[model samples]
Target chain A: MTEMPATEMPATRFPKEIAPWDVIELTIPVRTDLVVLARLTAATLASRVGFDVEEIEDLRLAVEELCLSLVRNGDDGRLRLRYTREGDDGIAIACTFEAAPGRGLRELPVDDLSIRILDALVDEHGRSSEGGHKRAWLRKRRSRTVA
Target chain B: MEQAFDISEREGTAAPVVSVSGEIDVATAPSLRNRLQARVAGGDTTVVVDLAHVSFLDSTALGVLVGALKRCREAGGDLRLVITEPRILKVFEITGLTEVFSIHPTVDEALEAPPR
Candidate 1:
């Protein structure tokens, strides 16, 4: 068995937060390798948004959950990420994808365990219909003081 | 893209309870994370994440739990993990998380502990 080169691993552009903070979006192919890349990218972005060690971990988890949801929905298209900064509170991130009916994210019962955990990881979350696509939005609050 | 495990958690008066009854591989770890996050969001700090029913656990799953503990602490709370199976406990022990977080022999013990 041969090993993959470090550079061959999934790599994406790191968006810069110029105006206090701006939502950075990226499109990556729906592949497991890219999923790991997405997770790492989210971690880097969270750090840039002034997340502490703990907050970084939370962001990573959020990204993983979002990507996992996409994978489950057979969202093998492009993975979309929206990164934004919420005033004094923290950064808001959204990872979305397109899925067919009864395919994307079914509304887990309000008391559902997974839904509850996803909500806790982020400060704000919801689902919406846009352009005949179902999207899941997740927000991560920055714990550090904005400079 | 892969099939993952199904995770569920319930909070009692004393401790929060978690039930993971499937494969906790990369595909299913997110569900576990999602469920764990929900519990923390509801202001339930002292948590008992039961791993007894789980047959599998990977690094991603471990990361999810560790992150959950960090979140609980930030919110002035803590997490207790229950691992009755030897395989799961071995992972905790190998990862050194066994020393980092409180691990109980049963879910009852985890839930019974006073909130931190």
Candidate 2:
């Protein structure tokens, strides 16, 4: 696959204190078969955040890309996801794995295609080992229309 | 709470056609690889993959298609794809696969297009 240069995207931070009502959490086994649960949750949250239909679909697809990348390389574990609402601006979804054993942070999908997809779909996409937690995340902003 | 991922193929056409429905992710992409590989190994390199009914597909699915495309070209045949879903199409467009494979909006169109 041909590698495309990474496109620089505007980064947004997840809220410091997301209200309980502004967040949704789900923990599921790191199985490819169950990643659909994450996609479903993404759609629901995007809709609640006032994302357009097409944007909601993009969010779902973006979430699928992130979740599948984690589950495929991960061993027996649980994927914990935190969906934080940035008020009326956008939504940020972060995923981290609690590995069963021999757990190490796997890099964000290295496939050129997966990287391109993530770059195109979300405003911020990345992987990190912050505070000893292997985390992957993507943040999408609702498209704003001006009259 | 059922996750649907199904594939149906018919070899009666000049080029066999595989119609797939539901999401195609890592878990189910192998099924797609197996079907396409079987057809190619059986000497049917010119196959039509219809993804009209499929609403979602990811990189794993893309990898399977790329592999099949390589096998088909090496055998003097090609894999024509019918994908009308904009969301799925965007995946191809994003990854530059739009230029790599022969994509059509309909099966009939894909079947009639000249092989790449």
Candidate 3:
């Protein structure tokens, strides 16, 4: 078979390169003692994206609140956290249970205190399920600086 | 006193333990708040909060501390803190309260430190 001309040939394009620290994944036990790990990681990523001090704190608390909610309702499971950068303005932290094979995500218990605290702490907060994994997410935007 | 946590004051001193030394999260923050509120309302401003024994605190705890700090400042005094645990101090650092509150390694230093 004769090859097509270069103009008629299809070119392969690689996927876009992900920025450094654009995406981070952490897996830890679903234990109360380990919630601090999530909080510190969230705060560090938020700071890297230029979030102000107060915003960093807000994200830190939001992550802590969410993680505690998961740990309280869970038992001896593993938690998977995905930190994805949202443009250059902020960060989004998504949490899910790393359940065993053939297992469904447990019902996460969100107390009144957690609800009220999260409402006051994060820019966006909610839960979602994709494929099979269930995820709870909270997003925080970098505070705009005064001129 | 053996419930979620305990709140006590040093004898013969106007300073109340705004610290509420325990895991001061949503479950225990109210106790700390009530103690701080009572002290400030009782005319005990510029209190010494010894959180050195505390290992964990959340935003609710932070809010309670902030509220107490505001009330103290309005009364022409301030809220000083004694925090030795790095984990506990990290909460204040991340929240930017490290700059707002006068933090010391010891209660005596916190008590003796000048107010902002």
Best by TM-score: 2
Q: Report clash pairs, candidate 3.
A: none
lDDT of 2 by residue, B1-116 (tens): 33378999987777999999988987899999999999999999799999999978889999999999999999999998999988889899988999999999999898889866
Expressed as tens digits, the lDDT of each residue in A1-147 for candidate 2 is 333333332344644566789889999988888888899899999888888888988898888877755555447788899898886769988887777667765444457777788889998887655555566788998997623
Question: How would the candidate models be sorted by TM-score, starting from the highest?
Answer: 2, 3, 1
- Per-model TM values vs. the true structure: 0.47, 0.89, 0.54
TM-score of chain B of each: 0.86, 0.95, 0.89
DockQ for every model comes to: 0.05, 0.81, 0.08
When summed lDDT is taken over every stretch of 10 residues in candidate 2 chain A, the lowest stretch is A1-10
Candidate 3 - chain A - TM: 0.76
Preferred candidate (DockQ higher): 1 or 2 = 2
Give the Å shift of residue A119 in candidate 3: 1.6
1 or 3, greater by lDDT: 3
**With candidate 1 superimposed using the best TM-score fit, by how many Å does residue A36's alpha carbon deviate from the native?**
2.0
| Residue-by-residue lDDT tens digits, candidate 3, A1-147 | 111111211111223455775999999876555776887799788888888877776787788776755544335677899898777676777787666666566665455445555777777677655556556777777778635
DockQ of 3: 0.08
Cα lDDT tens digits, model 1, B59-94, are 567768888999988888788888887766755665
Quantify how close model 1 is to the true structure by its C-alpha RMSD in Å.
14.7
How would you order the candidates by DockQ, starting with the best?
A: 2, 3, 1
Query: What is the descending lDDT order?
Result: 2, 3, 1
Candidate No. with top lDDT: 2
